[model samples]
Target chain A: MKRLTLALMVLMLSACVSVEYVTPYDPVIDNGIREYKESINTLAKNLGDQAGTEAGTYEANLAHYNALESKIDLLIERANLQSAGRGCRLAEGISAQLAKVAPEPMIQTEEGDSYGCTERLLVLVKDQLDLLQNIHQSADKCNAMASPRGTKISCLRATTSKAAMKITNQSINAVWVVETAKKNGDNG
Target chain B: MSVNFEQVLANILDSAASAFGDGWDSIKTYAPAEFKKISSQIVEIAENVAKYQLNDNEGYSAQTGKLLLQMQRNATEGVLVAVSTLTLIAVQNAINAIFASLRETFNDALGAIL
Candidate 1:
C-alpha cells in the first residue's frame, strides 16, 4: 500500500498519469509556429517594396501572401489542439513552404512598369515562401508524431540547401523598389 | 455539441473537493456557478465572433471587431482574476475542514483515554 501510494503521489505530482483531460503546453512548437507566421508576413510585406516594377502584381502578391499567413495561423492553432497527439497535417504543410523561401534572396528587375514588365518577381517570392511553408508544416507533423527534438532540428536543416540555392541564384536588379520605399518612407 | 460542460465542471469540483478534505465541499459549490458564468461569457464572445467575422487585413471589424477584440482582451485579462481570488477562499475552507477533521480524530482518541 505504501509503494502504491508513493507511486500515485509521484504520478499526480508529475501530471503524467492517465488523467482524461489535461492540456500541456509545448513551448517549442507553439513559439516556433507563431514566429514562422510573423516572419512570413514580414517577408511578404517586404517583398512589395523589393518588386521590379510598380505594377498591380506586387500588391496582389502581398494580398495572396497575407492570406497564406492567416491560413498558417489557423493551422498552428489546430496543431496546438492536438499537441500531445498526432498533430495537424496543415501545420506540417505551412512549415515546409516556409523553409523553401527562407534562403531565396529577393530578386529585383531592371525595367519598371514603364518597360512593359509584368513584374512577376513578387509571385516568385510567394511561391518560394509557400514551398518553405510546406516543408515546415511537414516538420511540425513529424515532430508531433513521437518525434525526438534532435531529429526535428535535423529535418529543418535538410531543406536549407534548396532554399539557399534559389536565393543565391538570383541576379539582383538595380531597380529594387524596397530601398526606394525605405528612402521615401512609404509604409502603406 | 452540447457537451455537458457542467458535468465536466462538476467533475473538476469533485476532484477538488476530495483534495480539500473538509467543509470545503460547501465552499466548492460556489465554483460551479462561477464556472457557469465564465462559460456563458465565453459562449457570448464566441457567438459575437460568429455573428460578425473579422476581416483578414483589418483584423476584426473596426466597429464590431474592435469591441469584440477589446472584450476578448478584457476577458483574457479578467478570466483568472475571479477564479484565482476565489481559490484563496477555497484554500481557507479546505484548511478549516482539515482542522475540523483533525479535531474529531483527536477527540476520539481522547474519549478512548477517558
Candidate 2:
C-alpha cells in the first residue's frame, strides 16, 4: 500500500512536466530557407563565372543583392511573428556559450533578444549576403582604379566565391537541421 | 483496484528507455557529423584564402580573408546553436513520452483522475 501511494505521487507529478524547449516547426519558414539557399548558390555561381566581366560589377548586380536582402528581411519578420515565449532556449544558450569561446563575438542583430532562433539564423544569412556584396564591390573598386593602367581585375575571385558558397550552405544547413528535428523528431 | 508497483515500474522504465533510446541515436549520429562538416568548412576557407593570396590578379587582401574567417566562425556558431536546439527537442519529446506512457496506468490507479 505504501509503494502504491508512492507510485501515485510520482505519476501525478510527472503529469505536470510539460515545458516548451523550442518553437513548433513552421512549414513556411522551412521552405523559405531552402529556397533562399538555392538562390544564394545560384548567385554565387553567376558571380564566379562573371568575375572579371562588366556583369560581375557590384553596380550591375545591385538589384539582385537588394532583392535577396529584402527577401531575407521578410523571412526574418515571419520568424519573428511566430515567436513563442522562451523561444528556443537551447539555441539561445548555445549562442551565448559560443560567444564566449569564439575568437570574435558572434554576429547579432541590433535588436538582439527581440528575435528567436529562426530570425537570428536569417539575420546571419543577411550578413553573409552583405559580405558577398562587399567582396564584389571591393573588386569593382580595384578595377576602377586600375582601368587607366590597363591592368586586369577580377570582381569576385573564384576561390573567394567557392568559400562564400560553402559558408553560406553551412549557415543554411544550421537552420535546416533545427527545422528537420522539429518536424521529424527522432529521425531528424 | 490496487496498483502493481513492479509492473508499473517496469512499464515506466521500458517507456522511458524507448523514448530516450531514439533521442540518443539522434545525438550520436547528428551532432558529430555536423561538427565534422563545419570543421572541414573552416579548414577549406583557410586553405583557399592562402591560395588566393598567392595569386597575382585574383589575390584577396588580408582584410577580405579575415572577413571570410569571421563568417566561418558565425557559421560554426550557427551549427552549434542548431544542434543544441535539436538535442533539446529530443529531450523534450522523451520526457513527454515518458509522461504519456504513464497516462493509462495513472488513469487505472486513480479512477480516471489522470
Candidate 3:
C-alpha cells in the first residue's frame, strides 16, 4: 500500500514539472520587432519627404532615393518575419523540453536565455537607424542649400549620392543580422 | 576664359583639401583605429575630388558629386564599425567638420563664379 502511494506521488510531481516547463513566456521578441519596424517606417517617411523636395530639380537623384526607401521597407518586412519565426522557435523549444521531460530548468530563466541573440539583433537594427538619421540630417542640410538664386546643386547631388550608398550598406548589414539569427536559431 | 576657370576650380579644390588635411591631422591621433582607417579614406576621396577638371567637361558637377557621395559613405561606414558610443560620436564630429570645410570651399567657388 505504501509503495503504491509513493509511485502516485512521484508521477504527480513529474506531471507538474512538465507543465511548468511547457508554459510559454511572454514574447519579448515581438515587442523588439515592433519597435524596429516603427523606426524603419519613420526613416522611410523622412526619406520620402526629402525625395519629394528633390524631385523638382533633381529627378535622377530622386529616383535613387526612392529606391533606397523601397529597400528599407523590404528589410523591415524581412526582419519582422525572421524575428517572429525566432520567437516561435523559442516557444517550440519550451514545448519540446516539456515533452522530453528534461530535468533542466525551463528554457527561459530569470536572466533571459534568449537575450544574447536578441540583443545582437537589436544592436544591428539600432545601427541601421543611426545611419538613417544621419542621412536625414544630410538631406535636411541639402534642402537648406536649395535657395532659388544660388542653389548649391553640387552639394545636393553629393548629399543624395552619399545617402544612397549609406542606405545600401545598412541594408546589407540588416540582411546579415537576420541571416545570422536564423542560423543560430537553427543550430540551437 | 577656360584656363582661368580651370585654375580657379583647381585652387578651390586644393585649398579645401589642405584645410581638410589639417583638420584630420589634428584629430587623427586621438581617434580610434577604425576611425583612422576612415580618415585615410577621406583623404583619398579629397584627393580624387581635387583631381577632377571642373572646367573641362559638362559632367564636372556630376563627377565631384560622386566623390562627395563616396566621402559620406566612408563616414557612415566608420560610424557603423565603431566599437563604442564615444567613438561613434567622435567619428561623426570629425566627418561633420570635414564636410563643413568642404562646403565652405564650394561656397567660395560659387561666389567666384557668380
Candidate 4:
C-alpha cells in the first residue's frame, strides 16, 4: 500500500510537468517564409544590378516593394491567427524557459500579446523589409543627383545591396529553423 | 514484487539530464553561430554606412543617421529572440523526457505490484 501511494504520487507529479513545447507545424508558415526569402533575394539582386539606372529607382520598384510588404503582413497575420489558445500556451512555456536562460531583457512583440515565438519571428522579418525599403528610398534620392562626371551616382551600390540581403536572410532563416523544429515533432 | 521510489526518481533525473544535454547542444550550436552572424552583419551595416558617407559629394546624406541604427537594433533583437526560442525548445524536450521516463517506470512498478 505504501509503494502504491508513492508510485501514484510520482505519476501525478509527472503529469503536472508535462507540457506542449512548440506550436503545431503549419505548412503555410514554412511555405510563406521560403517564398518571402526567395522573392526578397531576387529583388535585391535585381536592384543591385540596375543600380543608378531608371529601372532601379524606388519609384519604379515601389510596386514590388509594396507587394513584398503585403506578403509579410499576411504572414504576420497568419502567425497571429495560429490557434490562439494553443499558441498562448506555447508562449507561456517559452516565457518560463526564457526567464531561466536569458539574462537580457526580453524583446517586445509588435502586439505585446501571448502570440508566441513564431509571430515575433514574422515581426522581425517585417522590420528587415522596412530597413530594405529605407535603404532603397535613400539611394533613389541620392541617385537623383549627378557627380562631377555628369553621370548619376549609384548610391545603392552592389555592396550595399548585398549587405541588406545578408541581414534580411539571417532573420528569415531563423523563422524557418523554428518552424522545421515544430514539423519534426520537437514540440514535446 | 515492489516499486522502488528511489530508483524511479533516479531514472527520472537521468532522463531529464540526458535529454537536456542533447537538446542543449542545439542551443549551444545555434546561439553562438547566430550571434556571430548577427555581429558580422551589424559590422557590415556600419561599414556600408561609412562608405556611403565618404562617397556622398553632398553634405545631406542621412542614410544611417536614424534608419540603419534601428535596423541594427532590430537585427540584434531578432537573433536574441531566436536564441530564446531555441532555449525554450530545449527545456521543453527535457521536461517531456522526464515525464516519459516517469510514466514508463511507474507503469512497470504498478504492473509488478499488482
The lDDT values for all models are: 0.33, 0.66, 0.38, 0.65
The digit string of per-residue lDDT tens for model 3 on A40-112 reads: 4544544445542544234334454455445445544444444443321123322242233324432333333
Q: Best candidate per TM-score, number?
A: 2
Report lDDT (Cα) of residue B3, candidate 2: 35
Model 1 lDDT per residue over B1-114, tens place: 333456645654554444334544444444455445434444443443344345322111224322332333222222222222233334444554555565556556544644
Q: Per-residue error at A14 for model 4, in Å?
A: 8.7
**DockQ each:** 0.02, 0.21, 0.01, 0.19
Q: Judging by lDDT against the true structure, name the best candidate.
A: 2
RMSD to true structure for each model, in Å = 24.4, 12.5, 24.8, 12.2
Tens digits of per-residue lDDT, candidate 2, B58-111, equal: 546666677777777667667655655667777778887776677655666676
lDDT of 4 by residue, B1-114 (tens): 333444533543343334345444566666556555655655555555555578754222356434654555565556556655666665667777887887878777777876
> Which candidate would rank higher by lDDT, 1 or 3?
3
Error of 3 at B42 (Å): 1.3
Candidate 3 residue lDDT tens string, B9-49: 35433432343443434334323343333344344444434
The residue ranges of model 4 lying beyond 4 angstroms of the native Cα positions read A3-17, A83-106, A109-115, A139-155, A185-188, B1-26, B57-66
DockQ of 2: 0.21
Fraction of native contacts, model 4? 0.38
Candidate 4 backbone overlaps, count:
0
The superposed Cα distance between candidate 3 and the true structure at residue B27, in angstroms, equals 24
Model 2 spans with C-alpha error above 4 angstroms: A1-18, A84-97, A100-115, A139-154, A186-188, B1-28, B108-114
* Clashes by residue pair, model 4: none
TM-score against truth, every candidate: 0.21, 0.73, 0.28, 0.71
Tell me the interface RMSD of model 2, in angstroms: 7.8
